[model samples]
Target chain A: MEFINDLMQYEFLQKAFFTSIMVGIISGVIGSFIILRGMALMGDAISHAVLPGVAISFMLGINYFYGAVLMGVLAAVAIGVVTQHSRIKNDSSIGIVFTAFFALGIIFISKAQTATDLTQILFGNVLSVRTSDMWITLVIGGIVLLTVVLFYKELLVSSFDETMAQAYGLPTRAIHYLVMVLLTLVTVASLQTVGVVLVVAMLITPASTAYLLTNKLWIMILLSALIGAFSSVVGLYFSFVYNLSSGAVIVLVATFLFVLAFIFAPKQGVLWRSIRARKSKSAA
Target chain B: MTGTVSVKNLHVSYHGKEVVKNISFEFNSHKLIGIIGPNGAGKSTLMKAVLNLIPKDKGKISFAGDSVEQVRKNIAYVPQRSDIDWDFPITVIDTVLIGRYPKLGLFRRPKKSDKAFAYKCLKQVNMEEFADRQIAELSGGQQQRVFLARALAQEAEYFFLDEPFVGIDVASEKTIISILKKLRDSGKTVFVVHHDLTKVVSYFDELILINKQLIGAGPTQEVIKPEVMNKAYNIDFDLLNQMGVGV
Candidate 1:
C-alpha cells in the first residue's frame, strides 16, 4: 500500500511506468503480427542488428536512436535481399545478417572514444529513461498504432494468408516491407526498456499468450495489448519495491503470463487438453 | 464473364530449368474449365502463369485484350487449402472479408456492407453458422467452404481454384461443384485444377490437359481422349479404357 503511494511521488518511477507500458503496448500489438507471420526470430534479428547503428551514432555525436533505427531497417532490407538472391533461406539469412551487425556493434563499442556501457544498452535501464526518451517512445508509439489501425485489414489478410493477399492484388511485397518498418519502429521504441537481447520476448510473449486464448484477430490484439500493459505496470511496481532490473522484470512478467496461458488457457491449454483426454479415455 | 484470357508461348523456369515449357491457350468467360495433369506436371505453374502470379520467362498473357495487371481485379484465386496457415487467428467472416480488399484498396477498412456481403457468401456455402468460428477449428471440408466463400465474396468475373476438391467431404465437394456450375451458368469463367478423372465430363465444360506442357485442351469429351491421356499422364491402359477415352 505504501509502495503504491510512493510510486506516484517519484518522477523517475512515473516515467518508468509510462515508458514500460507504452513499449509493452507497441511490441505486443506488432508482436501479434510478428508471431502470426512466423517472424518472431526476425524481430530478434532486427533488434540485435541495431546495436552497430547505436554505437556508430554515439561516435558521430548524434542521437543513437536514429542510427539504431536506420541500422534496424537496413538489416531488414539486407535480410530480404539475401534471401531473395541466395538459396540460404530466410532463417539462415537472418542469422547471417544479425550476427554480422551485432559483431560490428561490439567492435564499435570497444573502439569508441567515449566510455560506452554495453550492459546498459543491451539490458536497458527503464528506470533511467530520460524525458526526451519518453517523448520519443510516445511519438513513435502513436505513429505505429495509427499505421496499424489504418492498415489493419491489409496486415490481417496478408499475414494470415499471403496467397490470398497476392490474389487480391493487395501489394503483398509492400505489405511485407511495411511490416518490417513497423517492427523496426517497435524495436526502437522498446530499446529503452527491454533492450536488444529481450525485446523479442516483449514482442512475442504477450501476443502468443493472447493467441492461445482467442481465435479472432481483433480480440487477440486487444487481449495482447492488455496483457502487455498489465505486465509492464506490475513489473515496474515489483522492480521498484524489490530493487531489480526493470527491463528484466518486465520481460519476466510477460513470460510469466505466457506460461500461465500455456498451462491454463481454456480449451487449448496443455492441462485442460490432457484432463479432457483422460476423461474421454476413462469413459471409453 | 466479360473477358477472355489469352496465353501465348507461356513459359516458367526455376534455376534455369523450365517447369512449364511453351504452353499456349486461350479461353473466354462463361465456361467452367479444368486443368488436369500428373503430379509435377506444372498444372499449378500454368494456372499461376496465366494470372501472372509466377514470373513468366517467355509469354504474353492478356485479359480482355488488356494486360493482366489492368484486369487482375476480375480474377480471384483460391489457393490449395494446405498452403494456408489454418492455425491463424481469424474468424471465417474476416477471412471472407479479405475478398473485399481489392475493392477496399490499400487504406480503407472493410465497410459494414462488406461484412454483409461476406455473410451472404458464407450463407451461399452453408457456412454462415461458422462465421465466428476460427478457421483452424473447422474440418477440412468446412475450411474449403470458407475459402470458397472468400472467393465468392471477391465478386470476380473469373475464378481460379487450385485443388478445391482435395481432402474435402463429399457434401462440400458437391456444394463446390454446384457453385462453380452456377457461376458458369451465370456467364462467369471458372477454372479448377482437379485430379479426379471420373467426374470431368460432368463438372467442366472444357479441359486443359497438361504434362509439363500443353498436351491437349478443348471440350471435355474431345480433350479426354486416349491420345491426350497418354500425353498428360502415364497411367495404365486398362484405366484409360475404364475412363472411356478412345484409344
Candidate 2:
C-alpha cells in the first residue's frame, strides 16, 4: 500500500507510466511488422547502433532524441543500401555496423567520463521521464500508429511478395526504405522508456507472442499492443515496489509472457500440439 | 495501340558470367506467347531484363514505343510461388488489395472501391472464401490461385508469369490454363514461362522456343517442330517425338 501510494504521488512515476503506455502501443504495432519480416535482429542492431549517435550529440550539447533518430535512420539506410547493392549478406552487414557504432559509443562514453548519463542512456532510468518527453512520445507514437494503419495493405503486400508488388508497379523500394525509417523512429522513441538494451525486447516479445496466437495481421497488432501495455504497467508497479530497473523488469515480464504463450497458445503452442497429437493417437 | 516492346542485342550477366547471351525479340499487344525452354535456358533472366529487374549490359528495350519508365504502369509480372515467403502474416484479401497500391499513390490508403475490386478478383479465382485466411494456412494450389488473383487484380494489359504451373496439382493447372485463356480472349496479351513439354501443345496458343536466342516462334503447332525442339532442348528430336512432345 505504501509503495502504491508512492507510485501515485511521484510526478516522475506518473510521467513514466504515461510515456510507457504510448511507447508500448507504437512498439507493439511496428514490432509486429518487424517480427513478420524476420527483422527482429535488425531492430536490435539499430537500437545498439544509435548509441554512438546519441553519445556524439550529447557531447556536442544537442538533443539526445534528435541525435538518436538521425543516426538510427542513417544506420538503417546504410544497411539496406549496402545489402541491396553489394554482395554482403544482410546479417553480416547489420553485425558490422552495429558493432562498430556500439564500440565507438563505449569509447566516447569512457572519454567523456559521464558515468551517470551513460548509465541512464544504456540501462535507462524511467523514473526520470519528464513531461516534455512524455508528450513527444505520445505525439510521435500516435502519428506512427495512424500511418501504419492507413498504409496497412501496402505494407502487407510489399513484405509478403516484393516481386509481385514490383510487377504491379508498386514502389517496393520506396516502401522498404520508408519502413526502415519508421522503424528507426520507433526505436529512438522507445529508447527513452525502455532504454537501448531492453528496447529490442519491447519491440519483439509482444509481437512474437501475439504471432503464436493469431494469423490475422490486424488482430496481431491489437493484441500485441494490449499485451505490451499490460506488461509495461505490471512491470512498472513491480519495479516501484522492489526497487528494480523499470526497463529490465518490463522486458523480463514480456519474456515471461512470451514463454507462456509459446507453451500454451492454442494453435501453435508446444503443449497444445502435444495434447492434440496424443488425443488423435488414442482415437486411432 | 500501345508501342512495341523491342529487345535488341541484349546480354545478361550475373556474377561476371553471361547467363543470357545477345538476344533480341519484339512483342506487341496482340498475342498470348509462351516462352518454352528447358531449365537453365535463361528464359526468366530475359523477361527480368525487359522489366529492368536485372541489369543488361548491351541491350535496348523500348516499351510500346516508350522507355521502360515511360510505360511502367502498362506492365505486370507474376513471379514463381517459390519466390515469395508464404509464411508472411497477411490475409488473402489484404494480398489482393495490394494490387491497387500503385494506383493509390504514396501515403494514400485503399478506398472502398479498391477493396470491392479486390474481392471481385478473388471471386474470379474462386478463392473468395480464403480471403480472410492467413497465406500460410493455404494449400499449394490455393496459394497459386491467390497469386493469380493478385495478378488479375493488377488489371494490367500485359502480364508475364514465370513457371506458373510448377508444383501445382492437376486441377490447378487446368484452372490456370482457363484463366490464361480467358485473359487472351479478353484481348490481354499474356506471356507464360512454362517447363512441362507434355502440356505445351494444349496449353499455349503461341510458342516462343528460346535457347539463348529465339529458336522458333509462331502458332503452337508450327513452333513445336523437330528442329525447334532439338535447338531449344538440345535433345534428340526422335526422343521428343517418341514422348509426343515434339513433331
DockQ of each: 0.77, 0.59
- The DockQ leader among the candidates is 1
Query: Which CAPRI quality tier does the interface of model 1 achieve?
Result: medium
Would you list the clashing residue pairs of candidate 1? none
Tens-digit lDDT track of model 1 for B1-247: 2567778888899767899989888888888999998888888888888877778899888777888778777778999987899899888888999888878786788899999999999999999998888888899999999999988999998899999999889999999999999998888888899987878888988999888888988898898877668767776646757777623
lDDT of 2 at B31: 65
Candidate 1's C-alpha runs over 4 A off are B236-239, B242-247
Candidate 2: global Cα-lDDT? 0.81
lDDT of 1 by residue, A97-191 (tens): 99999999999977775654888789887888889889899999999999999999888988887876776577888989999888998898888
In angstroms, give how far residue A106 of model 2 lies from its true place: 0.9
For model 2, residues B1-247, the per-residue Cα lDDT tens digits are: 5634677888988878888787777766656788888888888988888788777988888876777766666666888889888766678998888777767766777789999999999998888998999888888888888888877877777788888888888887788889988987787778899878877888887887778777876788888877768888777988757887544
Model 2, C-alpha of A151: deviation from truth (Å): 2.9
The number of the candidate with the highest TM-score is 1
